[model samples]
Target chain A: MTMSEAIEGRAALALLERARAVVDPPLRTALDTLPGPLRRIALYHFGWEDADGAPADGGAGKAVRPALVLAAARALGGDPLTAVPAAVAVELAHNFTLLHDDVIDRDPTRRHRPTAWTVFGVADAVIAGDALFALALRILAEDPHPASAAAAGRLSACVIELCGGQQADCAFEGRGPREVSLAECVEMAIAKTGALLGCSCALGALYAGAEPERIAALDTFGREAGLAFQLIDDLIGIWGDPARTGKPAGADLVAHKKSLPVVAALRSGTPAGAELARLYRTPLTGADVRRAADAVERAGGRDWAQLQAADRMAGAVQELSRAVPDPAAAGDLLDLAEFVTRRSR
Target chain B: MTMSEAIEGRAALALLERARAVVDPPLRTALDTLPGPLRRIALYHFGWEDADGAPADGGAGKAVRPALVLAAARALGGDPLTAVPAAVAVELAHNFTLLHDDVIDRDPTRRHRPTAWTVFGVADAVIAGDALFALALRILAEDPHPASAAAAGRLSACVIELCGGQQADCAFEGRGPREVSLAECVEMAIAKTGALLGCSCALGALYAGAEPERIAALDTFGREAGLAFQLIDDLIGIWGDPARTGKPAGADLVAHKKSLPVVAALRSGTPAGAELARLYRTPLTGADVRRAADAVERAGGRDWAQLQAADRMAGAVQELSRAVPDPAAAGDLLDLAEFVTRRSR
Candidate 1:
C-alpha cells in the first residue's frame, strides 16, 4: 500500500480504538443486566468471556459501526462524548445481528472464534441475540438526549430493513442459481449490511442535533460506504488468502452464496455465466469451486464488482461532502470508509 | 357458572373485541410496511392470511394483552383511544415472543393452525419475529406521548427478562426431570409469561400519564394475573378435555414438559413424585401419560397449582385496587383477568 493509504488505515484504526474505549464500558454494563445464561452467551458472543464464563482475550469485531457513529457526530461539530451511548447502542445492534446471522447461516466461526451458537447452542444464541437487541433499544430509550427517540425510531426501522434483507438472502439461497438478479442481490446487501451503517451515522447526526437534511446526507454517505465495503468483502470472500481471511479461497463459491458479484456473474448472460451457473447447480467439489471462481472472473464479475465498489465510494464521498463541507471535518469518516473498502480481507 | 361469573366473561369478551377493533388497524398498517416475505409470514402468524397468502379467518389471538393495555389506560382515567398505539405495540411484542417461542420449542401449531416456523420455516419465522419486535419499538419511538420513552424502556427491559425466561425454560428441558426446581420453574413462568403482560399494563399506565408508583402497581397487577393464567394453562395442558384444548389429555405429561405443575410434582418428595419422575424418564405411551398425570395429582401438583392460581388472582386484585381504587373503574381489568384464569382450555 502507498504511504497515504497506510496513514489512512492507521488513522481509521485509531478512531476505532477510540470508539471501543468509550463504548465498551457502557456496552458491558448493558449486557451485564442480562440474566445469567443469557449474559454468559452475550459475553461470549462479544468476546469478553469464554463459553465457560471465564474472561477471554478474544477480540470483538473492529467496531467500524461505532467509529462511524462517533466520526459522523464529530464531523457535524458535535461532541463525540455526548454520542457515546449511541455508539454503544450501534455496536450492540451490530453484534446482535452477527449472533443471529451466524445461527441462520450456520456459520461455525466469527472473529476468529467459534460462533456463539456453536459454543452455546442455537436456542441460547438466538435468545441472547434477542436480549442484545432489546438492550440496544433500552439504551436509547433510557438515554436523556433530546434526539434519543428519533434515533431509536430510525434504528428500529433500520433493523426491520435488516431483517428483510437477511430474509431475502436466505430465500435466495433456496432458489435456482440464476434465479436471483443482480439488482435484487444489491438491494439485499444494502438492507442487510448498509442499513445499520446508515443508521449508525444517522444516529450520530441525530445526537449532533444536525438538521434533518444533514442527517439524511450522513445516512446516504454511510450507506454508500457500507455498500462499497460489502462489495470489497465479497470480493475477498472469493479471492483473499486463507491466512488473511481465515477461510478457504472461493468460500462463497463453494457454498454457492448468491453474493453481489456472483449474482452479477450469473446474470451476465455470457457463456462464462452459463458455465458458472452449471457449476453452481450441484454441491461443488474443490476443482469445481476453482472453476466457478475462474468463470466468475471470466464473466467480468470481478471487474464489475471492483468498479461498483469504486463508484459507491465516489457516491459516499459526495454524500459526505454534502453533510460536512470541510474536507478536514470529513477526514476521519473518509479514512474509516476507505479503510473498510481497502482491507485485503 | 354463577350469574356474576357469566356477566364478567361476556364483559371481558366485549372488552377484547373492542381492543381488537382499535388495535388491529394500526397493527396491520405497521405490518404492511414489512417487505414481502417477512410480511407474508407475519400476516400468516397473526391469522390474517393463510400460508398461501390468501386472506383467511384463522383468527389472531384473543388480543388479551392489548385488552389489558386499553383497560389499564381507561382505569387510570386516560383516554383509551389515545393509547391505541401502545396497545398495538404490546400485541406485536406478544406475537413476536410467540413466534420465537414456537421455533425454540419446535411446536407445530398455534391458535389452532400450523405455527409460523412450522409453516414458513424456522429462518423465516425467526426473521419475522425480529422484525415484529423492531416494529413494536418503532411504534413507541414514533409516538408523541410524553411517556413514550419510558414505555419503550420498560418494554425493552421486559423483553430481556422474557428472553432470560425462555433461555431458562430451554435449559430446564435439557436437564433431568428432577433437576429443575419448582421455584426455578415459577421464575421462568413469570419471566416468560408474566413480564410481557406486566409490560402491557405498564405501557398503558405510561400512556395514561400515571405516576411511576401507579405504573408499578399496574405492572404487578398484570404480572400476578399472568402467573395465575399460566398456572391454569399448565393445568389445562395436563387435564383439560382434548375437545376444548385441541390436544390430547395429559399433553404436557406426554411431552414431559417442565411446566410449573410438573416441577412442583417432581419436587414433592413423595412416592408419587418418584413414580412421575420414572414415567418422565422414557417417552410416555398413552397409558403412561395418564399414569403420569395421576402421579402428579397424587403428589399434590394439581392442588398446588390450583391454589397458586387462586392466590395469584387475589394478589392481582390487590395490586389492581392499588392502581385503581374504584371498583367500577377497575371492573374491565378484573373481568379480563378472571376470564383468563377461569378459562377451561
Candidate 2:
C-alpha cells in the first residue's frame, strides 16, 4: 500500500503532535505539585529530563495511543484538538500501565533507563502511577463539561481493561506450552494491550461527536490493530537481533517465555513440540538459545505465528477499511498501522 | 449516640446497602473473567474469602465511605438509592487504596487476616488493586446514559483527590519533622482522607438531583467531619488498646510514623519536644515506642491532638449547620459524625 493510503498516517502523527501541546499543561501542573524527588523522576519518565533531572528535549516514546485518539477525532470530522482530554487521558493511561508492568514483570529498564519503581522505590512509584492515573481522569473530566460523569465513567472502563489485561498477563507467566493457545494469547493481548488503545480511539471519537455505531467500529479497528501489533512483538521478542531489540537476542527463549511461536509449536504436537518441552524443562542459558530457537523453527512455530500475525493484520486492515470513510484521516491511520506492526520499534 | 442512631446516621450506608444489589452481579461478572488463582485472591481481599481462600461472610466491610456518599445525597434531599453508583465507587476507591497501602506499609493483617500481598505476592496484590481501581470506575460507567457525565466527572475529581492525598502520605515517610508541620500534616489528612469522604457525599448529592449549592455544603461538611474522624484515628493509632487497634500497642511509634500528635509534640519546642527529637533521631524499636509515647504525653501532645480534633469536630458541626437545611438528614449526619469520632472503630 502507498504511504498516503494508510490509516490517516500523516494526519495521525500530526494529530499526536498537536495533542502533545494540549496534554502538556495539566501534566506539568501535576509534576510541579509533586515533591522535588518524585516530580523529577516522573518528569524524566515522561521523557522530559536528563539523568540528573535537568530539563531536556523530548526523550523517548511515540505517543501512539494519543495519536490514534486524535486521528479518530479527525476521522469523525471534528476538531481533533477538542479531543485533547481523550488524547492526554490515553497517554497517561499508557504510561501508568507501563510503569506497573515493569514492576510486575521485573524488567527494570524502561525507555532505556531504570524503571520508576526501581529508581524512586516501590512506594513512591506506586503513588506516582496513581498520580498519573488521576491526572488522566482529570484531563478527561475537563471536556464533555456537561457530560463529565459519563466521560469519567468511560475512563473507568478503560482502566478496568488495562488493569485486567495486566493481571491476566501476569497470571499467564508460568503457563504450560499447550495452555498458551494462539487464540487465548490473542485474547489476552487484546485485554492487556488492546483495551487501552482501542478505548482511547473510541473515546476520542466519542468526544469528537461521533455516533455510537461509528465509535464502536473505530474501537474494533483499534483493538484488532493493537492485538496484531502485540503478536508481532512477541515474535520479535524471541528471535529478533540484539541490535533491533536493543537488548540481548533470544531473551524470551532464555527466559522460557510462552510467546506465540513457542506456544504454537507446542500446540502443533509435532517434533518441535517434544523438543521444545524437553528444552523448557532444563534451565535455559545463553548457549541453549540456539537449540531453543531451532526447535521452534523446525516445528514450524515461527511460520505459524507469522501466519497468525498476518491474519490479525488483515483483520485490522479490514476493520480500518470499513470504519474510516474520510480519505485523508483514513490514509493516515493506515500509515500508522503499517508503521506500528512493521517497524522494529 | 444510640446504636440504632449510629446505624441510621450515615446516609451513604443506606446507599451502600442499595449498592450491594446494583454492584453484585456486575462485580461477579468481571470476577468471573479473571483467572482462577487471581480471582480467588482478589475475592479474598474484597472480604469474600477467609485467609485460606475459602468463602466466608467476612467479605463485608464497614462501608464507611459509601455511607458518607449516600448521606451526602440524602442531605441534599436526593434519593439515596440514586447515588448507589457513587456509593459503590467511593467504597471501592477506599478499599483499593487500602490494598496498596498494606503492601507499601508492609502490614500483615487487614480486617483481622493476612493482607492480600502478604498471602499473595506483592505483584499479585498490585494487580488486584488495579482490578478494584478499575472496578470503581467501571461501576460509575453504568450510568447507562450520556446525561450522567456530571456524576462521572464528580467521581473523577474524587479519584484525583484520593491519589493526591495518597501521594502526600507516602511523601511523609522520609521527611524530617520540620519538612512536614502538624498543620500541613492535618491538611494532608484533610486532602487524603477527608477529600474522598467529602467527594463521596458531594457526588451522592449530585446524583440525587440536589441543587449545586446543597451539594457544595454537604461536601464541606463531609470534608471537615472526615478530618475529625482521621484525627481521632491518629490518636487511636498511637494510644488505643491493642484489642481495639488490632495492632501491637504503640504501632505508630514503632514505625516512627509522624502522627499528628507526634508532630505536634515535636513542634512544641519544649523539653518534651527536644527529648522526642533525640529519640526520633535514633532508629525506633518496641522499647523506643514506650519512650516516644511518654515523651509525647509529657509534651502534652495527646492533649493538644485531642483539642485539635475537637476543633475539627466543631468545624464539622458548623459546616453541617450551614450545608444541610433539612433537619432530619442533617441530624443524621451529625449523629454519624459523633459516632465515627467517638467510637473506637
Candidate 3:
C-alpha cells in the first residue's frame, strides 16, 4: 500500500512475467511429447486449451515457483537462461500437484475455471497428473547441465514429502478440530507448500553451482517464505473478499478445513476456541459459518497468524542474507518473497 | 510339461528367487525412507505387512521384472550385481503401477489379499503410489553409474507412456464391445503391460553399457514377451481353473472386461461374435458366462489368442538373439520369458 511496497509488487510481477516468457516454450514442448489423449488433458489443465480441444488464453498461474527458481539462480550468480529447464520442471511439478490435489479435494474450480477432474473426469485427470510428473523428471534427466542429476534427486524427494503432506492433510479432515496440534499443522504446511518452494530455490542454487551450504541456505529461505505465504493464504481463505478470492467468505470454515489458524484457534484452549470447536462438530450453516469466523478471531487465531507470517518473513530474509550477502543481489528474490506473502487472493 | 520345459521352469524360478534376495534389501531400504504413514501403506501393498501394521509374510508377487533386469544385464555381458539399483528401481516402478491400477479399476484384491486402496482408502493409496514412483526415480538419480542418467530418462518417458496406456484402457470400458477395435486393444495392452517390461530391460541394458541398438533389441524382446504374457493371462481369465487362478472361471467375462481376447472376438464379424456382444451388453449370469465363453471360442478368439501368444514368443526369441547371440548367454532371459507366458494365473 506504501510507495516501496508498490514498487516491490511491480518488480515481483515483472520477474514472474519474465519467468513465464522463458519457461512456457520448453514446458509446452515437453507437454507436446505426451500422447494425444493425455496431451489434451494436460493442455486443458494448464489453461492452454479448452475441454473441447480449442485454444484458450486462460492464465496458467502467477508462475511464483518458476520466478523463485530464476531469481535464486541470478542471486547466486548463475545465468537465468541456462536454468530455464529447472524453472520449467518446477512449474510442471507444481501443476502436477494441483491436478491431483483438485481430484483428491473434489473442489470444482481452479485458476478461475473448472478443475481438470471436473472437465475430463477423475481417471483422466489422475493419469494426466502422473504424466506431468513424469515429464517433469524427464526434463531434468535430459538436461545436460552438470547439476541436473542432483536437481532431479532433490525434486523427486520433495515430491514424496509433498505427497506425505497431502496424506496428512486428508487424515486431519477426518478427525475432530481439537485432535490436531498446532505443531502438526505447521509441519503439514511446510511439507505441502514449503517443500516445493524450497526445492525450486535449491534447484536454482544447484544450477548456479553454489556451494552445498549456500544451497541449503537458499532452501531454508524459500521454505520460510513459503510458510509465510501459506499463513497469509489461510488468513485470506477465512476473510478474503469473494470478489478477489472467487469463493465465499469463510469457505474453509464451511468445509471444516483444518487450516493453520483454525487449528491454532482450536488449540488455544480459550472459551472462544471451545465454541469454535462445537460449531465445527456439525455441518456449518450460514449463521454458524459467521459465528465460527467470529470465534476464531475472538480466540486470537487471526492475530497469531499475522504475527507468525511476519516472523517467518523475517526468518526468510535472514536466510536469504546468508545465501546472498549483498542486498542488491538479493533484491529480486526478496521482492518475490514479499509479494507472495502480501497477496490477498 | 516336457524334460527341457521342466528344467527351464525351475531355472527361471531360481533366477526369480535370486533376484528377490538381492533386490528386496535395497527395495526395502528405499521404501524405508518413506514417512511412517506412507511406508505402512506401501508395505501392506507389497504384502510385507498386514493392514493393521503387523509384519506379515504375505509374499510380494514374484520378482519377475527385477529378474528380467538382472537377466538382461547378464545376457549383455555385464556384472548383474552392479545393476542391483536398476533391479530395485524396476520393481518399485512395477509396484507403483499395480497400486494405481488397482485404484483405477476398483479391483478388490491383489496378490490374494485386499487391495491397498480398499484397506487404506483411496486417498492414502493414491498418495502411496505417487511416493513409490518418486522413490523409484530417486534411486536412479542417486546412482553413481555412468548410465544412470540415460536410464532415468528412459524410465521417466516409459512412465508417461504407461499413463497413456492406462488412460486408453479406462476409455475402452465405456464403449460397446464391438466398438473397440482389435488393433486399439493390442496397442493398449502393449502400452499398459509391455511398456514397463521393456523399460525394465532397457534400464538394465543401459546399466550394462550396452550399445544403443542392443538396448533397443532387448527392449523389443521384453515387450514381445510381455504381450505374450498378457495374451495368456487373458485366456486364463476366461478358462483357467479356479484352484489355479484364485478366481472363479470366466472372471473377466463376469466383469465385462474387454480384454484382448474378448476384443478380438467382438471384432470377428461372425454370428458367434454377435452373440458374444449381446452377452456383453447385459450383466452375465453363471450360465451366461459359460455361453459367452463358448461364443468367444466359436468366434475363434481362443485359437487366435493362443496362436498370437506363440507368434509373440517367437518374435521375442528373435529379438533376444539379436541382442545376445550366444544361446548359453541368453538362457536366463529365455527362461524368464517362457515362465511368464507359460503361467496359468
Model 2 agreement with the true structure over B126-214: per-residue lDDT tens digits = 87787677666666666653324565566656665666666778788778754678877887788777887777777777777767777
- Model 3: what TM-score for its first chain? 0.97
Candidate 3, residues B233-309, lDDT tens digits: the string is 99999999999988898999999999988988999999999999999999998899999999999999999999999
True contacts kept of each: 0.94, 0.53, 0.82
If both were scored by DockQ, which would come out higher, candidate 1 or candidate 2?
Answer: 1
Tens-digit lDDT track of model 2 for A2-41: 6553444565566556656666775577567654555676
TM-score for candidate 2, please give it: 0.91
Mark the regions of model 3 whose C-alpha exceeds 4 Å error after superposition: A285-290
**Whose DockQ is greatest here?**
1
Query: Which 10 residues in a row give candidate 3 chain A its minimum summed lDDT?
Result: A56-65
Tens-place lDDT digits, model 1, residues B126-159: 9999999999999999999888899899999999
* Reference A-B contact fraction recovered by candidate 2: 0.53
| DockQ for all candidate structures vs. native | 0.92, 0.49, 0.86
User: Could you tell me which 10 consecutive residues in candidate 3 chain B have the lowest summed lDDT?
Assistant: B199-208
In model 2, state the lDDT of residue A165. Answer: 65
- What TM-score number comes out for model 3? 0.97
